[model samples]
Target: ISRQKRTHKIILPCFIGGRSVSRAKSIVNKDGCYFDFPNDAIRILDAMTRSSRDERIVIGKPVLRKIPVGTKIQLPYHIVERNLHSVSIPIIKSNFIAPRQSTPKGLRFPLAAKAVVRSVVHKRSSGAVILDIASRGQLNDTLRRFSHMFARKLEGVYVQPMAKPGTELILGYVHDALMGDVYIAGIGGSFTEDVHDIGFYVGKPDLRGAKAMLAQLRHTSIITSIDVPFVAHQIVRLSRLIHRHPEIIELDLNPFIAYRRGGIAVDARIVTMQT
Candidate 1:
């Protein structure tokens, strides 16, 4: 037999002429019996013939690779992680404030806290989520309880502050394989899926596209009334979000509340093709 070993710098000969090569190879281990072709037949024969205690060996492929396995992975969770690391958006950081903390200034609400990081959008058969808190103590307790319900850590929870309708809008960007990046403007919130009112345009859009979308909406009258503030400025901010990140694939600003002058994405989800 011809082989190389560390004992000798070069190839060395073992059992010069007496050793006979076999076609099959086998090894006995504690686990189970293992055998494979294109292997060392001599080793297989030796192990079989040698006297040993009853033991099991695994018989399988010539070689098996080991991989460090973890818990099962979810697609949506993975997408969220990717977006968290790669996508750039002008949204509030959920971790900045402690759980059950009040929303910062300029984003305050009457009944509910503004800029809550909602779990999912569109109230499906599962129903909508509500985190009611009469006082700060209840808020902290609810925040802690919600932490255990989800798969991952609860960075931010939903805030249901009082908000006037027609102020909130949807802003999004999708990567078109053909057209490159496309921006979408539409009225969103609970009625997003139900209403399905929106406008689509390609590339970085100007104020024109934003106005066009707002004008076409059924609730265009609310923006004109001027009773509340932050109606027009919110649209401009939404427009800027689109212009800032051209690589965004899909985004959701569902039920963004427009209060006085500026708007806040009370609930939003963003997807990025760049990841």
Candidate 2:
């Protein structure tokens, strides 16, 4: 043992890989099961940290659920929007046209439409998402093109008014098999991935954590142009939203248009496990 290990009386963490424990009493000296391997490891680690002179919580809780054996299904835009109302994601109002229906009355012009395809990620450039329908003729033309392009895979159409311009931001979360849910905040828009300016965080979200994350961005001063606190609060809310909905394995709110008074999500994608 290293001198430091011996001095601190550290507990060696056990990972039950291939080795068999026929007795199978418990991993944590008769307190946990083999099915909960890594969790047991985490519990042990937390115990070891508590043994420190200054004790504190290591990882507060496990956010993501155990892996399920089923096909992955993405929640379509309409369902996502409906569910998001409860979470207060500041999503702009939108409508759907599955089973092929006419446009809802009273929707303003300069709208956008996206295809309800399960396998593909919709993007404006890919033609899965079409933007800027200035007139009814343009809307019809776009729908026909969308119909022709998607054909059998097409489920329906998602239509929403074009959102107003605002400073763009991104709120994203990933359910990591090992680390659990990892949330991210970053500069957003069409090139969010390309720019690669982001901050990653672990643990439950709060205003403090959200503010700290936004502060890490390259352009920290950009907060002056928008309601920085609201943006930060949105990040916190999005994290909690995912925490509440374990079915959501991955989610992205890119180009969350942020204006002085508030912000709105122009585009969103949620990946989930089929129940």
Report each candidate's C-alpha RMSD, comma-separated, in the order given. 21.0, 16.6
TM-score of each: 0.47, 0.69
Poorest lDDT segment (10 consecutive residues) of candidate 1: 10-19
- Compare the candidates by TM-score and give the number of the best one: 2
Show where candidate 2 strays beyond 4 Å: 1-71
Error of model 1, residue 216, in angstroms = 2.0
Worst 10 residues of 2 by lDDT: 56-65
Task: Highest lDDT: give the candidate number.
Answer: 2
After superposition, candidate 1 runs with Cα above 4 Å error: 1-128, 144-166, 225-244, 259-262
* TM-score, cand. 1 vs. native: 0.47
Q: Tens digit of lDDT per residue, candidate 1, span 1-275?
A: 11212232221111111112111111211211222111223333344345333422211111211111221111122123223333332233232233444533333323343222234434332232443335555545555655555424344444445444436566665666699766666666666677787767676655665556556666666466432324434445544554554334566556555544455555555543322
Candidate 1: residue 264 Cα off by (Å): 3.1
